[model samples]
Target: MKKRFCIASLLLLCLTSPWIAVAQTVILESPVRVVTSSDRSIFPESWLSPDINAEAEVLQESQIEPSRRVLYKVMKKYPGHILARNLETIYVLHRLKYKGISASGTNSRRNVYVVNRGSRERYTDAWIERTFHAEFSSKLLRNFPQYLDNDVWKKANVESFKYGVSGVKSVKQKKALKMFDPSLHAEGFLYAYAKSTLENDFNSIAEQLFLGDSRFWSVVNKHQRIKEKTDLVIAFYHKIDPKFSRSFFVSLAEVESAEIG
Candidate 1:
């Protein structure tokens, strides 16, 4: 009986040891709920440290706005505990920091879409990514390596000015487009729109499907047959949203198309 009791006690201690070690190592100042959000697979295999520590490290090192740091800190401490949901946000911020985008005062002012929210409130990754995705897509659109032949960026600029987007491409057009301010547009399916507008007859209706509207589809159904534009929309949305399917935008567009049909 004595031997059996000792064996049982040893087994219990061994079982609990892992938890004990985790607890000791995870012992954080301020009882950080946000810092405690470690053990997630969302972080890249390379970050090496625990999540919350990385969060703190990122906040300390990254050039993300002062307002953002304050907001994240409040979120870490507050009742909303929104940091738990912001794993992708953190990752993007880290990547942005890596790219030195945060440090660019001119770049920061020109492009980002900042929305105000309460510390205790939560936001979705999609919401955050949609905003940040612009940075990526804009960069993708603007900087085409060896883009002199059929340059999409230049072509789009010329078309927008031709279409009377802010009244004619002027001498300052190149300077204006170079600035970060042109990226603030909430336009739908940007890549598709750029490509589609370049089509001789497709015109605005091809781009309009991205606006999440029906009337454009009606016009499309009645007047046109450019199937590639739809294909482009599907492809571009999947770029912005990895999980998006043809049926997803199709359904949204169908609603608008049906209404106007």
Candidate 2:
């Protein structure tokens, strides 16, 4: 009887081992990695150009975990394969600058950089998350411009309206990048900085879409121009991946609001 019981116990363990291993693997896996400036490989080769003058500070030890949590929350919304193929690393720093100008965040080939909240800075987790989405969307836009119909995007804007030369110039001028202005909604723009360029406009919409900002949906529902542009943005994303459907974003917003509530 004792020998028979021991054999049964060993068989049970063998039968469940693979299931336990899968559970452990699922718990350990993360879509992307959050790194600091200490990892020299995070810097892009373009920064080496004399004209770039890019500078960054290493993140404080206390800031690392919070930054990771925020990034993980944002990245987990996408499919793992999408993340692996596009973004792999997030570099969190105390500060970032280029050409001697301060920047809240920026992206290189496959890595994105964001500034940690400082004593004097107004940076918040929401802001950081939005920056991550905005910068990453820029990379996606560049990688797959064919899906972004410039003619369709331009038509959605006000007739005969012209965009500013560059978003960089708008940032350099100290414009409020994220402020929501009702006055701009009729023009199919969500914020002042979006009017700076087509890419910035797309980035603004992309950030709001991915962040699942309720206010953005409110505006989209009330204004025809904003709704039109929003549809274009949704179509652009859906074209890139079928997973980015309207229902997915609607559900994402509900989930975000529930977490906040």
Candidate 3:
């Protein structure tokens, strides 16, 4: 009968809709979901608007599990309330380029784009985890600039130091952006990349903070400038959430080192 056919059609539409499929794939444990699809519709309009020229490839199915594991671990470091209020999704890709330059990761206010390690890629698990923390911290800084006082951060640096115009410009000019350099720690910088911009400086510290490794602490303990910068970073996160204290970070570092051992 025509009534029976109409009912069947409605049921089929609901079952096969893309929205339904996407909803089912959502991660329930956290507010943020790991998105692997390259489909534009899968991303929110606001996320796409800012980076219209960004290009990405779908993440390989085999890489999804490992990528998700790393992402979830990084997300777990943040307070639940902070994650719920600030982050919505993380889009994993085999490759991601913005404005024709290859980038390890980038972010908008609510979403992050990260290139996952491919079979042929040389990226390590540590690099991927650092990328997530770095990019996510950039998003958080943008969302809550008041927590980080630029003058205070600058005061931690050498008197004559000045950051480059932008991270993109630094990349375009082929400036060194290495992740760490003990020499730079004496100057209140983690590496050459930290000089690219204030945001980059913040990101460098944030990645190491979230990483909570012994190497980072060793430098912070030995270098007064690095210690000053680290203190500011700790204060910034603490302002965002009181639970993110100096002791909390020290304990986090201890736990991470124990696991590595």
lDDT of candidate 2 over 212-255, digit per residue (tens)? 88888899999888888778878888987899999888887888
Instruction: List all candidate RMSDs to the true structure.
Output: 16.4, 13.5, 5.7
User: How much is the lDDT of residue 184 in candidate 1?
Assistant: 24
* Model 2 residue 30 distance off true place after TM-score fit, in angstroms: 3.3
Residue 123 of model 1 has an lDDT of 29
Q: Residues 57-149, candidate 3, lDDT per residue (tens digit)?
A: 667677877787787888888888888788888888877766557788888767888888654686667788888888988988988999888
Candidate 3 is scored at a TM of 0.83
User: Which candidate do you rate higher for lDDT, 1 or 2?
Assistant: 2
Question: lDDT score, residue 158, model 2?
Answer: 86
Off by over 4 Å in 2: 1-29, 38-41, 118-120
Q: TM-score of every model?
A: 0.27, 0.84, 0.83
Each prediction's whole-model lDDT (CA): 0.32, 0.79, 0.79
